[model samples]
Target: MTMIAVCALWGMLFSVLLAEPVQAADLIRALMFQEAQRVLITSGRGLVRQFPDGAEQVMTTPVVVTQLDGGMTLNGARAASDMVKVRGRDDDLIITVAETPVSDQPQDRLSDKVSDAAGSAVPPAELGPPPMGALRGPAPLHTLVLAGAVQVIRRGKSLMVINEVDLEEYVKGVVPSEMSSGWHLEALKAQAVAARTYALYQRMMNAGRDYDVVAGVQDQVYRGRRGVDERVQQAVEATRGVVLMHQNAPVFAAFSSTAAGPTEDAINVWSKDLPYLKGVECPFDANSPYYRWRAELSLQDLENNLRRQGIAVGTIASVTPFSFSRAGRVGRLRILHSEGELILRGTDFRRVVGYTAVRSTQFEVQSVGRTIVLAGRGSGHAVGLCQWGAKELAELGYSFAVILTYYFPGTEFNNTRFGAQAPSSTP
Candidate 1:
C-alpha cells in the first residue's frame, strides 16, 4: 500500500513538472502599453509644447524643462506661451504629452520621428542649459488634446512643423545607418521600455551610445569571419548551458553569439593561453580596450568549482553575460586599474578555488595545440535574446518578441495575459 501511494505521488509530480509554457495569445493581452517618462507634442502647425506626465495636466505655458549632462535636457511645456519648472534632484525630465503633435502615429513612434523627421516641425529649440532658478518663474497649467501636425524647434523658442515622411526616412536611412545594427538598438529599447522618468531615458541613451561604438566594431569583425552566414543570428544563438555565478541568485539563459566576442575571447585566453594570472597582470598583447581584461575559464574549471559547492555540472553551453543579471553584474567583481595591469576584485569567486580574477573579457587559450588565448569579451554566458542584440535584429526585420523567442529555445512566444504562460498548477 505504501509503495503504491509513493508511486502515485511520483506520477503526479512528474505530470506537474511537464506543464506547458504560457501561450502566445495570452501573453499579448497581458502585455500593456507602458507609459513614457517624457513626451514632446506638436500642438499645431506653428505651436508646440511638451507634457512630462502622461494625461495629467491638460495644458501649460512656457514649458517645463530640465538639463542633463552630456547634451540632454527635459522639456516640460504644455503650450507655446508658458512652461512649468519641475524641481528634483535627478537631472532628467518626465514628459507626459506634447502641445503639438507632428504625426498621427502613437507616442511610441516618436523615436522614429526624432530619428528621421524630414524637416523641422518647428525650428529646433535654441538648446542651452536653462539658467539656474528659472524654475521659480510662474507658469500656467491647463488641459487640451492636441490634434494634427505642428512644427517645433529642437532648442529654439519658435514653433514649427516637421515632415512625418522625413522622419520615416530618418528612421530607415539615417538612424539605422548611424548606429550598430543589433545590440545598441536592443539596449535603447530596453531603456525606453524600462524608463519611468526622463533622467532614466538619458541614462539609457548614454549607455546606448557607448554600447553602439563597441557593438559596431564587433559586428564588423564578426561578419568578416569566413564561411559564416546569418552571422548575427548565429552569435545570438551561441550562449547556452554556461553558468554565470553571481552574488544574486543565478540568472540562466542562452545569449546570442554576436554579443559573445569580448567575453569569450577573454575567458579563452585566461584559461588556455598563458599561465593563470595572479593579481593584476595585463593578459593580452592586443592593443585595444579589450586588452585589459584578466580573467579566464573553461568547463573543467567551472565544474570543479561547482563540485566544491556540491552542485552538479549542467550541460556545457556558451558562456555569455546574458545568463547573468540584466545589468550584467559578474558576482561582485570590481575593476582596478594601475601600473599597466588591470585588476578585478569582488565576491565574484570568493567561494571558488583555482579561478583567478581579471576585469576585461579578454582571455588566454591553450587547447589541442592551439596555444592562443581565446580572450573572451563581454561578461555573462552568451545566450538567448540579448536585449540589446535583439533591438538591432528588430531593426533588421525581427519583431520585438520574435527576437526574444529566437534566442530562448523551448520557450514559446505568445501575447497572452502572461506573454508566455506556465502550465496550470491545478490538476
Candidate 2:
C-alpha cells in the first residue's frame, strides 16, 4: 500500500481507539528539540545510557551528543547508531539536556530537511523555539531539566530530542506554564484537566508520529518540573485524569489567555467544528493584560515577512477586513498589492505578522497609510476555555467543573484510572 493508504488505515484504527477510555498510566512523548545541532546530556544522580542494541552503560560524567556524518558522537566517541536513550540512575529519572543550541540553518531550509527526514511537511516555525510564550525569543543558552527518559534521535544532519514522561507529570508541568500558578486553585484545576485532555487527544491522533506533542505554544507550554509548585501539584492531583469528554472521546480542549469578548468557535480558528467548541458569552476576562491592545505594522515589513514565508506578493496598497466570524473577529482580509489583490485568512495574517504583534483576529484596522495601525482585544485563538475567564469564575466561588462546563458546553468529566478521583459533580 502507498503512504496515503497507510495513513488512512491508521486514522481508521485510531478513530476506533478514541472511544476507549485513556489510562492515567499512559506515557506521553513530548518533543523538546527539533533539528538541534548539539546537546549536553546528564543526570543529577548519575546517568544510565541505553544504546540502540539494548546494551546499557552507566556514566558519571556529562555526555556531549553531536550529530555526526553517519550517526552521532557521544562525548567525542562515535556511536554508529541513530538513537540513544538517557535516564537517571537510582532516582526519579530526571534527565537534563543543557546548553543545547538550535540548528543555525535558515527556517525554510531546516523545515525542508526535517520534512524530508520525517516523511511529512513540518512547518518552518515549529522546527525552532516557540514564537510566543515564556520560551519565546532567542536565548544564548537553552536548558531543559526534564523528568523521565530522554531520547536523542539523529535525523539527517541534525538531532531531535524527545521526552517520554508520565501523563500526570506532563500535565503537572503544563499547568503552571500555560497559566499562572498564583491564580485561584479552582482555575488551576480546570487548566490541569484541559491540558491532560489536549495531550491525550494529540497522542491519540498522532500515534504513528515520532512524538505526541511539542513542549511549546504549539501544544501547551510544558517546562517539565520548572514551574511546578505546591499549588500546581495540588491542582493536578485534585483533577487527576479528569478530561472533558464529548461522545465518549476527549474533546480537543483548546484554551487561550483571554477571550476579550466572547469565546471563539474552533471552526473559525482551526476549522474543527465540534459542537462543544462553539463560541459563548465570556465577558469575565476584561482585566486581562491582553484584553485591550494596539499595534503598528509597517507595510514594507509586512511584505517582507510574507515573501520570507514563500508568499509571492508585490508592494502593498491597502489591507482591509473582508469578512468577520460569528464572534465578530476578522475571518478573511483583503491585501491590495501593487501586483494584484491577495486575500488571506485572518489567522494566517497573524502568523505572518507575528503572534505577539497581532495578538488576535478581533482587531480593526485603524488606518492603512505606510504603516497599519490595529486596535484589538484578547490574546490567542480564543477557542474553547479562556484562562482569564476561568480565573474570574474561580474567584467568584465557582467550582472547576462548573468553569469547564460553562466554557465547553455539553462536555462532561471522564476520569482515566490515575490520580485522585474528581468530585461527583460540579458544586
lDDT agreement with native, every candidate = 0.26, 0.75
> Cα lDDT of model 1 overall?
0.26
Candidate 2: misplaced stretches above 4 Å?
1-24, 51-56, 92-139, 416-427
Clashing pairs in 2: none
For model 1 the local lDDT of residue 127 reads 16
Residue range with the least summed lDDT across 10 consecutive positions in model 1: 27-36
Question: Which candidate's TM-score is highest?
Answer: 2
Off by over 4 Å in 1: 1-60, 65-257, 261-362, 365-374, 378-383, 386-403, 415-427
lDDT of 2 by residue, 1-427 (tens): 9999997886666446554444566899998777666777777688888876788999888777888887899889898677878877865444334323233221211011111122221232444543221133344456667788888889898788888888999999887666767788999898888888898889878979989988765576677787788998999988766777876667798887777888888888877889999998887887777789899999999999999999999999899999999999999999999899999999889878877677788999956669989999987788888887888888877888888888888887664343332222222
Best by lDDT: 2
